[model samples]
Target: MELNPWAVAGLVLVALVTYYLGHHSSRSATSTHDFLVARRTVRSRRNAAAISGEYLSAASFLGVAGIVLKDGADATWYPIGFTAGYLALMLFVAAPLRRSGAYTLPDFVEMRLGSLGLRRFATAFAVFIGILYMVPQLQGAGLTLGEIVPGAPAWAGAVVVTVLVGANVMFGGMRAITLVQAFQYWLKLFAIAVPTFVLCMVFFAGGGPAGMRSLGAPAPPVFPKDTTVSVKTNVTVKVNTETYFYAYGEIDDGPARGAAHWSPAVPHKVASGTTLKFAAGTPVPVVSDIPATNDTWLHPASGKITDLLQTYSLIFALFLGTMGLPHVLVRFYTNPDGRSARRTTVHVLLLLGLFYLFPTMLGALARMYVPQLLVTGDTDAAVLMLPSALLPGLPGQLLGAIVAAGAFAAFLSSSSGLLMSVAGVVFTDLLPGRIRDFRVATVLVALCPLALTFLVRTEDLSLSIGITFALAASTFSPLLLLGIWWRKLSWPGAMAGMIAGGGSVLAALIYDTVCGYTGTVPPWWTVQPALISVPAAFLVTYVVSRLTRSGRPELVNDIMLRLHAPDPLGLVQDRVVARFGQVDDKARTGRGRHRKA
Candidate 1:
């Protein structure tokens, strides 16, 4: 792919604008309270925009379309699950969590259960989930930059995003990025919505509704024109029909590999760095996991029993996981009151629903326009490549630039929020809760995930995010749901349930990684464990709480009332102030003594 000056300029423009907005807004963030929760002064609509902006990460921006391109009708569940999760959040968590007067998840854990040990344990999970969530945002950045400027090292974009996001968080914290994120939300919407409208017009003008009907055609997707595909990673592809193509590089590990005609009975392995050129009308050879024909792709639940199981697990993770995301939950703390938090969630649901419509449309369009992506398994690039593929010449490049900018904005906004949440947990739980410690924690949190981006290879962006959601669903979902509603919940039960849930997911992840290295396919449950893990977590929490009923906190009733009562009641005080009052006092005293000297 050739470099597009328009796309590069759009990326640079978005980055500069993000920095300026963050810098301008950060002026008021002089205290720890402002840094952590924006002084809890954000109103409903603006906070809703910021929350929506932060929630629509690279996975939503790029991976949803990519998955749609790969899986056809099956991909619809992702957006449904993602958007509906907010509905669940609004119903169960939004108001109650805001009324809890906790700045972070750990703060809530400690405040409700009155257990320092459980608080520390919850902190560990927060950091872990935050890091897991941040990884794909950085990887998506790399992918976007690479598409804009061909041949650029993937880490370059990751590093650029880390520096910008780290600077924003370290300097201004949540207050600074809140405005930036809100602004980016609209920009992203404009960027994606415009291109989608143009492409849909173009599609209809060329083929009309008859073209739409062809999506369910029995034949496999074919190249619209002569296309060249470069394999960045080794992949095994299944060719459903007899196809002849010109090959330059290793194919199937053959001794003499160049310019070969292929007949397909079994899967064929194409090594990385190989380039294949195919003529127009050639049926695309798709990665083994993808459906080889449009009919199969369009049909939902077309796979075996495992695919059905995986779909349910994916749904469970996404629906329950929203309430548990550390970054997402922290946004509620920025609301002025429980009412504002509830209103913000409603606004978020609407904004998210509007934005998701475009990606689902884009994904469907990609199957018709960008079939070459199937051959290389770079379906994540489907959204980035779609505008140019449908619209030719200058128009295509400009629209491509818009899509690229939106993709980058997705990376920036999401990464900033995740970094803030992780840094807050680190500062409050690990270090002293001083303003200076926030800066240090920001650096530490950003560096750990940035470094990991180098070591770990990028998978399907949405799939990776789904795993984190599963983990969150297993661990914190049970903790929050049980902690808030059940009077009998003990620290031991919360801890035990969290361990059972988190440990199961971790064990599955390890097994999956081992299978990847050994070139074996893991079970469906390992891929999406929420179906097993979520129920296990809830059951364990209930049973263990029953067994340990005698050890329940005496303040459970007060906490419960505080969580459920209306905002005017003021049933609870800010637990963060109570928990860290001594640290704050010591810092103040030290500063005063220094001034005296």
Candidate 2:
């Protein structure tokens, strides 16, 4: 399945254009707003696109499809969970967080707590989470590059993406990257959708791509309007004189991407054939060995406790983590007003919902048409390979090229944002006082993550990303949410929470990684530290506030006024618009000479 040269050319073009745009935008940037928040001038449509572009990584595009391909209905929850989490974000964090008018989480921390020490701790944690998330994006790019260019080594792709990302980050900062991400989002949508439409037609035509027929396409799992599928079933197995009800379908070893697992042999009787079916009110035969089938994350050995805890833990991490992500939170500061922030979030949900629908469909299609992906053992490649299989020769290459371009866009856009976030923290939060030292810090931040990429290797891109989320959820989420709503929060409380919550999650993460607790450890202990740590932070904040009571509330009127106000003042908004950067529309608006933010 070597990719066509033309496809490679298309990918190269996207990289060059993206780099060019980023570099050109940053040349004139001078102020803190230019470096961090893009001057709070971005329009709703572009801002929403940038948010979606940064949020949807290679993991969502390829990793989710691969999971669905291998794990039947159980994998469907990943997309549903991802999209539903955003609704939580819109309701709880979006407008209010923006109303605070902080650039990074650290900026918000300093404003809320008025403690430089606490701000530094929060910033350091933000850097850690950003780097962790950036690694997988680099790896994904390398993999896609290898597939697209045949003889191209994985490291070559990683290097290419890293260099491009660094260039983008160094050039325009947030303002420049914002424009690149906005364009890339639409390109990604087309890249995935067109190939999917073509393949669906191919599959239904009774002649799928070559080798697709032998794999036996199955009917996709349908979502029941109501709770028709049982929450769980007791599989009674008779072994000699003993009756045991054990779970079936547990991937005991690792991911189902061609990995084998061990299970006890059991004899079962069914009224039907090998193809199992269950009608309403009918008793379905239970395969008591395999766990986590049908979008139900169950541990057969335990009664629903394990699955229930896993679900809640995952939900907790995603809900809180959305607020903590430095890149996402940073975008809120780019909007002109609280209303613009709200509008941008609504647009994000719409764009992401539309984009997410396509990926879920692709995953379902892979399950039916490309079941042998189980043999290849790289489910993340499902999105890339399926397009090639469906369209042969030029069309296949073109599709492959498009997918590669989008994958690279996902990798580079995300890497660029993370790098920018890390740079901002290092420069603005960590560096003592000198502007020269801050510039050096920016270079150091970018280079450190790029160097670390060589040491780690893994195929579980989605899981790696989830780990980063867990860390962010534990640390910054609690701090930000509380700081925004509460007036009593002081430097001591914020600092105590930072060390207690952030340090604990970091320690747990390091221990988990080193101890080889791989295969998604028990959900409660593994999902996100927020479930335990968030409450602990609240307790610490409460205690610390009482002990070191600050007579005056910091920024109380500003925060409250911003939250409840209809829109920004006309003059203030005009100043923001005058300073805001846009691609190709500067001259038309007669705002060209101003510095880019």
> Best candidate per lDDT, number?
1
With candidate 2 superimposed using the best TM-score fit, by how many Å does residue 424's alpha carbon deviate from the native?
1.4
> For model 2, where is the 10-residue window of minimal lDDT?
223-232
Task: Give candidate 2 regions above 4 Å deviation.
Answer: 27-30, 209-303, 432-439, 515-524, 527-530, 538-559, 562-597
Query: How big is the positional error of residue 34 in model 1, measured in Å on the Cα after superposition?
Result: 0.2
Compose the digit string of candidate 2's lDDT tens values, residues 1-597: 555686688788999889877777766555555667776678777888888888888778777776665554555656666666667667777777666656677876765556777777787788888887888888888778777777677678778887787767765678678888888888889888887788778777865433222223122222111111111112221122222222223223222222222223544432111112222221122233222133232112244676556555656666677777887777877786777777888888888888877777787676444433432245677788777655657777777788777887888777777888888777766665243544566577766766677787554576667666666776777676666666676777767776777776666667666545352333345444556666676688768867877722566666555655555452122212233333235543333233322
Q: How many backbone clashes are present in model 1?
A: 0
- Candidate 1 lDDT, 26-140, residue by residue in tens: 7766678778887677888889899999999999999999999999888899999999999989988889898998989998898889889999999999999999999999999
Pairs with steric clashes in candidate 1: none
- How much lDDT does each candidate structure score? 0.89, 0.64
Candidate 1 regions exceeding 4 Å error are: 207-214, 255-257, 578-597
Q: Cα RMSDs of all predictions?
A: 4.6, 9.2
